[model samples]
Target: MASKVMMTPGEILREGELEKRSDSLLQLWKKKRGVLTDDRLRLFSGTSERAKELRFHSILKVDCVEHTRKYVYFTIVTTDYKEIDFRCTEESCWNAFITLALIEYQNRRAVEGFRRHRFQRVASEEQQEEPGEQRALSPW
Candidate 1:
């Protein structure tokens, strides 16, 4: 029989070596696909004081940049997570967002690698649709 072990967002992030890997902050969005404990979600969702301090709400989005035949790069969007009317200290929020962004980037990198190996003939704009339309038809 296998024993069950629970994981936290912090643990997952730390295990990936996200902090030491780059100068920027990192955040990984582990949804239903990844194993996450309720505690981890609570920590990430900012229900507790510690979570709030981490600036969980400061994350806006993560963008992956794909270069031809090159590794995908991640950029994290930063915002103020604080709900008060007053302005937040730029340093704290900025750092938090960056950290989260880095983690998310690392996570994306792993996923992208897995997908590339699993799927052949990955859809590209050039291959999927006919010319003359401004936008390519996305299966999404």
Candidate 2:
């Protein structure tokens, strides 16, 4: 049976190793330790340095490119249209975890945005009402 991948709300999502395609003349595949958080995906190099970060707010979508018998290849498209390619073992479900975490982060952001907009609208409406306006009391 296939394993299920789930995201932790408002927390670090997942951490694992992923093979990323480099943007060099040779275009080599390098191993990276990926830490998926609620707000960003942080990648660390095999050595001592932290490599790259892909924030969820700037990430547009995750696209699955291909699935071979041994690995799953996917691409992450950023809001600025930067495409990052990644591959992982088939059983690791890296693609699924990334997709799910991205969606959850987006949904949370949408809800927070809606709340802010609604609050601002309500406040504006309240301010627009004449301060000295009188209202009849409801007969209880």
Candidate 1 residue 59 C-alpha distance from true site, Å:
1.0
| Per-residue lDDT of candidate 1, residues 1-140 (tens digit) | 99956544555432111111222255333211111222122222222233322233444454443323422233444465322111113322322344454565557566988899666555564456555353555543
> Model 1 off-target regions past 4 Å?
1-5, 14-55, 80-140
Q: Residue by residue across 55-79, what tens digits does model 2's lDDT show?
A: 8889999999999999999999999
TM for every model, in the order presented, reads 0.24, 0.84
lDDT, residue 138, model 2: 32
RMSD for each of the candidates: 16.9, 5.2
The C-alpha lDDT values of all candidates are 0.36, 0.88
Q: Which pairs, if any, clash in model 1?
A: 25-98, 25-99, 26-99, 26-100, 26-102, 26-103, 27-100, 27-101, 27-103, 27-104
Clashes of each: 10, 0
lDDT of 2: 0.88
